[model samples]
Target: MEEEKILAIDYLATTPVTAKDKRLKARRDPWMSRVLRYTLEGWPTTVDNELLPYWRRHEELSVREVCVLWCDRVIIPRVERPAIIAELHFGHPGMTKMKAVARSYLWWPGMDKNLEGTVRACERCQQRVKAPPRALLHPQLLPKRLWSRIHVDYAGSFMGRMFLVTVDAFSKWLDVYATQSATTEVTSEKRKTSFAIHGIPERLVSDNGTCFTSSEFRTFCESQGIIHTKSTPYHPSSNRLAERAVQTFKDGSRKLETRSLNETLQTFC
Candidate 1:
């Protein structure tokens, strides 16, 4: 049943009763018929002004059976032009690709502009257009003092507990704290504990996770006189220091089997 429905849709899309097909059929009217007949009957010395160009370009032209004219292809009628463009763009290719495909088997004046217009107006193509290329990375300035700038991130729900990890940008010192949950309060508490040990950082960088972006986290940073900066969403390279520390901790934890979380943390430190 599904296959039959799909076939029926295909048939409808390609049916000859469409507006383009009807206009193509209408090309058999007097003026076009006469032009086709003249092309077939051989070039006239004094041709219709409209047809003089075709005759002059006759070396590039061909005539099909049933008196249809071809110039690299069956000369598409004006009303059927959009239909041909639509067919070539069925794959929703960009303007250049569509124009290349059309040129392979078709020719018409202003066809390039028409293909571009069709592609631009295509909803699917517009919706699926790729994002602009990312800008090159601009590295942050190095911290002059140890623990002045810290990159912080969370790692794990390993063994049902989460660990907050911080890495000092200058000294590369790492601090890890296990927490019951990754909520803003728990994360802030863990960060406070680390600040007490290393002294408060002048700047803190982190990914745009909920715990980092929460109002409570902002308030905590404000109270501590810490400048909070977030990396671009979904981009871990911008937070590479913290990410590296998290990976290191995870690797160490995985190596110690049958050890409690505190034991693993101690081993990692």
Candidate 2:
């Protein structure tokens, strides 16, 4: 039985590790190490109050190369979360960009709220994240496949920079970039990163902003064999999914704004 358990451990340690992984292994996190042990030895039928969160995700929890993974994302150790947050927030990415980066490969309880706290603590972000008032709109069309139809828009001069936000019509996956300019050229360059990863969408939707309506942008879309579309100019109820998505992004990031830190800790505690 011990040999079989050892074999299972070795088999489960196949995921590749990075400097981050090395650091994680060295830390010997009490909670994460316990979770790793449970994954190998099997979880108890019931858990302590502290282990309840991990228990809820026990079915998806996995051990990967000495790291605990929730799905494909690494379960960040509490001690390491601050560093991860700093790395992801290095570019001073806005709420959308921050969440996009965080959701890519990291997970911890209250991660989203913590990210929001980091942003709210920033005097600079509070100063520059002014966006247009959201307008009510009808439902936007959903696509059959990811990257088939995407709604794109600008969020703000957030953090003293322009943000280009694109929402996948199917997955609703958000792509955000912080740029010094919102020019058509810059927008095209930013979209290239997303397009490279997800492939160019067959249909691209955006409001009739100059960045989208400009002849240069039209040419760029044509070159990529993309079908460029514009939302109705003034009618709020027409087509505005991109704006709605941006609104959702902004709203979700700030939902915890009113809570005090001590209160936040008490709830989690």
**Which structure among the candidates has the greatest lDDT?**
2
* Candidate 1 residue-wise lDDT, 170-203, digit = tens: 8777788988888998998888788888899999
Candidate 2, residue 25: how far the Cα is off, in Å: 14
lDDT of 2: 0.70
What is the TM-score of each predicted model, taking all chains together? 0.46, 0.48
Please give the lDDT score at residue 118 for candidate 2.
90
- Which stretches of model 2 miss by more than 4 angstroms? 1-140, 233-239, 251-269
Q: Write the per-residue lDDT of candidate 2 for residues 1-269, one digit (tens) a residue.
A: 33322432232213233546645663667777788889878999998887788899999988766667777667777766777777555435567777876676677888899999998897655644775655433355456688898889987654455667788877777776667888999999988887998898999988888999999999999999999878786753233677876665455434434544333222212
RMSD of each: 20.7, 10.6
- Model 2, residue 21: distance off in Å is 13
